[model samples]
Target: MLELIAIFAAAASGDVDQVKSVQQRDEDIVVTGQRTEGSDDYGVSEQRTATRLPLSQKETPQSVSVVTRAQIQDFQLNSVNEVLATVPGVSVLAAETDRFYYSARGFEITTFQIDGIGQPFAFGIQTGSLDTSFFDRIEVVRGAPGLLSFTGNPSAVVNYVRKRPYREFHTTASAQYGSFNNLRLDSDVSVPLTADGSVRARAVGSVLDTDSHLDRYHLTRWTGYGIVEADLGPNTIVSAGYGHQDHDTDNAQWGAVPLLYGDGTRFDFARNSNTGQPWSGWGVIDRQIFGDLTHQFGNGWSAKVSVLRRAIDEDNELFYVYGNPSRTAPEGINAATGEGVFSYPGKFVGPTRNLTIDAYVNGKVSLGGRSHDVMFGIQRGAERYRQDAAYDFGQIGVAIPLSQLFAGTFPRPPFRRSTACTSSTAPRGGCPCTV
Candidate 1:
């Protein structure tokens, strides 16, 4: 477990209703404006992911949990999976070094959204790899949200609310250094870019380099993001942003070692006893460009249009060992017993591109002296996947003997260049962790 503590300072400000409340008497000016909601409460939140309506925690009719920006800073949660694990009734299954599956309500969750808009895109365990620095809050709604997300499954939905540009100028930076050659830095700055302060811009960056306790396990990662906003008029707002993240790992394990021998004799191995080939690892590079437009109508209704284009490029390789020992050869695995299997090398080199568009509107109507908020929207998403290599089944990789399992002295398998990984086959049990 990695433990870290940080000290941070924040400035708080609130925007009141547009109605000007001012009084001048005896050469003295007095102004009064009510705060947006109630007093500051960490336990309460104005959630929109549940119904696309601005409803307080007490008003929403669903089981929801909100991880606020303050909580993220206090707990030092930097990734999507770390934040989700802290939520109520959420569980994660880590099948591989890079694969993580989320489950809620006894079913694997496949529905997720950004700013309350969701697409038909199937989420992979790699969703955990997303950076959280660009978001203001994370909202999780338990149970099926077919009405809002249009997913008929009983799994839950997670929404990431992006941070908007601020007119005021503020900047914060933090750095940390720890064991195993670990070094990290995070910084963000928000500033006004116009004379009238109608346009704003914000930028955030992070860098990390760390070595794990496990032998030969090390990682290096970096992320950069920036956003700009313009207030075209009193009721129209537009914004654009770009985000990119890159990471690489060393000595990544394809699969765990065998637990017991073919004769039911268990093997006592050290924690770092890995079957990972020297050339096996994950090198991920992903980037996105997104923009959104919002217009507030004169009739108290609002509409929004959002578009995002994302691309994922990964080069990963793996080595797995598990099968029965061959009767004649001490190092060979028998096809029938399936115990002392030889090491096999495989690679995945598929890159995927995704374009998603979502639009929606929110308004209120009165009936029978009761007020109700209504919302409607449409979404379209397209994904393209390309493969550059292929895996051949008949040709097996290099094999090691069962006696050399713990000493790490066995001949490692040759690294196979990646072809098409989970990127394209994810729809067909390739990313079984996805669902």
Candidate 2:
């Protein structure tokens, strides 16, 4: 060992020289070159740079936009509709304070998804708005995402990504106030459960309340989301999570009628209707439950399954005066004893139910040194609708005496009393009149 060490030192020092002779061949030889501190090694940075996915840009196969939590916070966006309004090619028809008609790319988006699974539909006169507090990101894919989503409008698909737990302990909170007396508070906390940080958990919650610009309208919302993740092994991870949101609105108005003068000119309804009492008001309540499980195989493959249940209830009453100027009598002398006409009040109520089930598998595979990402899924959904309405006669009371009839007093008459009295074929109770 001593001789071997001495020979290696001599060779390294360049003190020995090589020769063609057998005797010289036994001597060690040294080669001269500059020594580098480290070898050229493949690293995370190198791999990332060498095989980076292209940033999404115009001309991509699909039109996609990403709304980050930071952007939502910056804009103080509270609902999905608010966020979507900022995107191009998206519009919302606010039928009422809580009810909305959402369309993108020239088509209505009736279906919604969270974490890429079908969420229930809030049908009928009710409203459905996605809360921004529970989501980490929102991805909008324009054009048919049929390959990844099912039973959705071909114009677009919205995927909401929930916040997940991390191995480190962290907490964040925020509060905001805005126009129309809007206020909101939100908080999130995440921590590891085990010393190795293999298991992690996180919780997030928020509350918001506000009065709308419309008369006698207000909104309140609350949401809670939690996630649990476990590192099964070096190459595998499993996660499960749940989220819930409850929303309520009171004194919501559908919309003001378009006002027109007798001359066929448009008038500002806001100014005119300001004097009239609210003809309609409503209360809406909606709740959502969501759960998901995901597992990753050792290979470049993984699977996720998610389920969501949403229920909605809404109560609405519309009060309107039923009358026709053309049916009025002469100024005085009881054109039947001419007086002003009376107006009957009418009200309508609507309710609905919706359910959806979605299941899918997503995975990636390597072939011929290339990676392919693929997703295939199936979905089934259904909705039920119901409605009822009632009408009532106001101050008019019983038939007015002809002696009391005067010029501007307006006439008060039952909708079908005369018709019912005249026709034997009329339905029982009264003539079936619709408002």
Candidate 3:
């Protein structure tokens, strides 16, 4: 036994020229040539909305623009409306104080999505009012949306790509202040839950409080998003998340003042002029729960299914004014005294609920002698909006001098419970409200 041990020891002592590295140290690996993939570049994108076939931005048969994260940061775009205003040919119309509508190519953009799954457009909605803090990028496609939506619209389609969690820990924060008491703050953090990074979690949140250029107008908004991702296997993943938005506005408006007075006199008003009452505004709250599952076959074919359940609650108090009035309805407007009679004073309360789900499969296929990307997909959605009807508090007699809004004092009218409207089709839910 002693002789055998001696011989083994001598053999284990290898020659000076023979050596092996059993483990690699940190210093041994250096990434000197590493570069960021999607750094701040203003140009076309590599991927776009899929339509049963894979296509690039340049190859897609429509105009496409990718609002990258870098551009969003550079311009400090806090909301989707602000981001879309930067797009050429798109118009952001301020329908009210926090209620904005987006129009492009002669049509209102009513379709919205997150990660390629459609989100319901609320009734009497002000599109693009969503907080953009949780999005990694926004892709806008102009013209007919085709199969991308359940019932496609003629205008543009916007897809908000959410930030994905990687097998790394990263965190970032930002704050900004602007005119009219504008203040916004945002933060995002991501971390791996497992040592191998097969599971991960990310959280993003923001707060915005500001006073508008309009007199007596104020807005407050708070938003939060949280997500968890699990890598089921080498070719499968599952993700779930929840997002919330709570917004409130004071002194909201329903319409702009008439352009012409009773005497057919055109008054040039200041751009910032507002006719909103101090007690009128909106209180809106929205929440969503979303989940996604994706699986990839070894042959490069992948399938994905995504679903979202959304609920919205809104409280609206409105005082709206309309066009000029004739002698038949003499109280419409009095040009001589700058007396304007608004349509109605009411409280509209409603809740909106929606559910949407979509599934798709895509892969590369050989046709003739060329390789082409092909995909097959199907989507379905349903929504129901219920309201308790608006309380027609009756119109008020106010004096708003054209181009001189600050000089006037507006009063909140009392709720009129008696239904004495002359219209035969008066909406009895609250009272007949018509212009």
Candidate 4:
């Protein structure tokens, strides 16, 4: 055994000397390198969502989950809801076809951030679906980060990080087709705008047109995003971007189906049955313009300031039906015999706008012969929301048969004057909300 070991060591030393001689002779040698920036990976080495200080998942005090670009692409998670549904300890609750609510740790998640900045929602909910085309990664903190997120929600805080311009020119695109007539296309491009590669730009967009399995239901959505980043100096960077999303859904359900008859008998309905009229739809538009400035000091201290302006508008034409039908067999609740079903049809439009600013300074200091991280931040936000609704009390009180509702035989009721005040005409002080 000792002789074999000696022979192996001599062979290894001889190979090392031979390689050194080749290098000294200036022989042609190929050098290769890899670029990790903007590359696809399932996990990241560090994250700052938990406390705004860089820490790995294992180092964070609270539970943290990072859905990286590679995971999203592999799972085909196009919507924010789809992405969160895959996370552990997080549940996505669907209120309807497009509306969703999220919960974690048995508590509802109400705090959502974009690049670590939170914004107020118009109706206390995300109005439309947020696409994942422009996002690089999603960080989920399965607990409260009270320092940054004002709301001390014990559930979780979700932060969406946008994709930045890569120093090298790169592009990617994909097309997908699936069941239910779903077709989707997306494109992402990054390019260097300056000779030194210090100035860069990126753009991402996606389009989706799909028909659901439910009868008379369909959806159309598209999103666009563009950003430009420039290095003002060696340690300073400034970036600005704009993003927009448009969502249109047809034949959206407003209420659930009745599972029991008035006589307390179970009723079986078709899985594909739709209770909404053909004209019923909900359209939403979302837009945002954001900019940020970051500077690094030689003393290991860094400062960042960010500003964002967001606008959201939605138009709703909906019909809600609810009632237990009689056990009259074939014609339980038809047009002629409207015994138990009732309908509420209305038109509504809501518009919301907000402006938010965030600034923070973070650094490490030596305390008691040990390094400790410290961060100080301030956030300011202002928002305005207004809704206008058209209603007719008579139509709301009328009874409509369930059979006729599904058959699309009933006609739409005439809309009367809007009872809710609009933002443009309302006084600055306030207006009466009749909705």
Candidate 5:
């Protein structure tokens, strides 16, 4: 058995060298653009042209960055946010383990596209984090893309190219673990469906679990995706795909307040300051579903459409205080007690829907010894969001054990009368506790 295993390993190494030699030869073989089908040179020329179109990075008019699959693999990135952070002029602000805030060139980016089709945006609702495992490539166009993307902020646009089935068969699996007890597993497979090799399919999926730096906080996620492609007769192709993801988090806080000293200087708080306490944590759940369809015409033209829907639910509890230091205490009140204190607890549930459809035709034609590229397209999209928040102070008990009221223990009172939560309808000319 040992001798047989050694022989097999040597044969595999020899095959690797042969494969490298063939690739080197292919790279050296070049042909003219006008080659007939099945001429052995047509496929090679087409692939070379596609590779060089975007190679002259400095010559492109727009600021663009391409994140290749190799780069993603090198960085061990499982999410789009992780991959985008390596690019210049981009930032990712994580609202929570399952939610993220993306900004570029000092402005918030609201628009995202898949294979050049728009992804709708919803305000005040979480757009679940994007999975990087299913993408073949990511293209970022910086600054205003009004001419490229129909409507959006001038910051930038992100285009995700999904993995498609090729003539070959391949499969890959990976697992990773990191700080904060993070763990993830991802698998992907692509193969041909029929002997004719005209029809193909690909599937990808992932599961993740992690604990946040925040006390008593953790998150879990699952995703699945599948795509199918068919060649319907000559000079025509069709493709369709669907994807779904679910994210859940527990004991998370919306955010923490900035610390200030006597001179207004800020300080960073300890990550685990509020451990194992009631009313000090929150939870949120988010889910998303999306689909796409595309068709190609023989005459250098194609059209594509994509749609996505997302839903988010959140629950939160916060504490604040209000009152004058010199004011007299009310009946049954202890003067030794710390300054006035207040508490506000609240819940918010939101459902968001988005639909975007677009069609475009592009072609390259020679006119008077020069090639002119032309593109014409139209797009329409609608985004709607509904939020239901249950706001009331009576449900939350009165402030007691000031240390318990405030997630962090401080010398100042937990309650204070300030414009932050003050309302004009208060009976005593002071702000009442409102969530």
Candidate 6:
């Protein structure tokens, strides 16, 4: 009888221990339902990319597509190109190994935003592969978004929402490897700096090195981003951040390979073959600094001001080869001797800088038992860039055998550029009020 009583007592103690563990687990989880950075959920409960006002997917009038952090991780969309390819009605164009462009609804996308502030692009092309490590989510607003965005492009507006520093400490790391010798590593860390969790900082970095299926093509890129947020009062907050990225590509083709030989007959080439010299390459460097200030009033009203400055530098060394190839002599190439020639080697450098500032206030008002939302916003931007100077490389390159070209055995001579250079500056500003 005494032994049976002892067993019951022990069972009661075990139940108490389990209950304590559950309580501790619940306390450790921080769920505010306001932020989606670390949610690991495929869809967001609220979105504000279309308009500064908070609204759900169903409430927003425009067609919106949100690519959350969970989707980015699950689908391995490490670069901006890969992420956009998954969005509906969007098309990605690879102009070359380093340059890319995107289009939606049969029109080129010219407006891109970061945290609901942006500048219109004069040329609708993106240089280098933009890493996706720093973004919490990407929002695509199809059709015209001129209600908020300054530019009235009929295509689409892409907004990249940055990940904010969490109130609690958290860290995550991941690595990926795939075909063609591709390897990627990503790391994100968030830390609270104040005892009351009023100050926080976050850092994100990524590195990627890979070789393409195309012959002699290779790419290496790395990115680093850091941000800090501090709460000044109960309803006010300020934040600042900086980011840097470097992308370098080697053996990038300037143009497509010859489709037909000099003869009328077809000249089929291997799928992996490319008409590029081994010495051709392009490199780009990007740096950005930004800050934000936000405040909330008691009457469901909020105001925010954001500013960003971005700079981009590019260096290009391109080799273009064009000619028809045929086994028969005189018509195209003589496979026996290996002799053909069509090559242009050139080098150029260009630099661009931009500064943008945006401020907005939005709130809700009730009248006659009905609530209405209104917003007023202003945006100012300036861009300065040097024009591309075409360098003079005397004479065409000497003829090299087709076999030698395919074997990566080609000579690269030095290029001389012009002494004169020109630059241009563009300024833009707008004020848009919506209700």
TM-score of each: 0.82, 0.65, 0.80, 0.86, 0.69, 0.84
lDDT of each model, Cα atoms only? 0.69, 0.54, 0.70, 0.79, 0.56, 0.78
Candidate order by TM-score, highest to lowest? 4, 6, 1, 3, 5, 2
Tens digits of per-residue lDDT for model 6, 155-256? 899998888898889999999999999999999999999977789999999999999888988999999999999988878889999999999888887656
lDDT of 4 by residue, 1-435 (tens): 654555567568887675555454443322211222355777788887888887788988888899988888889999999999989999998656667778899987888889989865434345457899978889899976666687657888998998888778989999999989999999999999998778999999999999887888888999999999988887788999999999998887765767788777887788787777777777889999999998877566788899999988878777777777777745565445554667777777778798999999998999999999889999998887787777666778566555575775556777685767655555432232212
Q: Model 1, which residues run further than 4 Å from truth?
A: 1-44, 119-123, 324-339, 388-397, 402-435
* Cα lDDT tens digits for candidate 5, 153-175: 77888877777776568788999
CA RMSD (A), model 4: 7.5
Top candidate on TM-score is 4
**Which is superior by TM-score, 5 or 6?**
6
Flag the better candidate by TM-score, 2 or 6. 6
Q: Give candidate 5's error at residue 342 in angstroms.
A: 5.1
Q: Please, what are the lDDT tens digits per residue for candidate 1 over residues 99-142?
A: 67888999888787876667444444552266678777788999
Candidate 2 similarity to native, TM-score:
0.65
What are the RMSD figures for all models against the true structure?
A: 9.0, 14.5, 8.9, 7.5, 11.8, 9.5
Model 3: CA > 4 A from native: 1-38, 43-45, 50-54, 122-124, 323-339, 392-435
Better of 2 and 3 by lDDT: 3
Lowest lDDT sum, 10 consecutive residues, model 1, at 1-10
* Tens digit of per-residue lDDT, candidate 2, span 208-320: 88876655556678888887877766544566666666765544433433343223354333421211123344444555555555554533345556566655554544322
Off by over 4 Å in 2: 1-60, 120-128, 232-242, 271-281, 317-358, 364-371, 380-435
Point out where model 4 deviates above 4 Å: 1-40, 334-339, 421-435
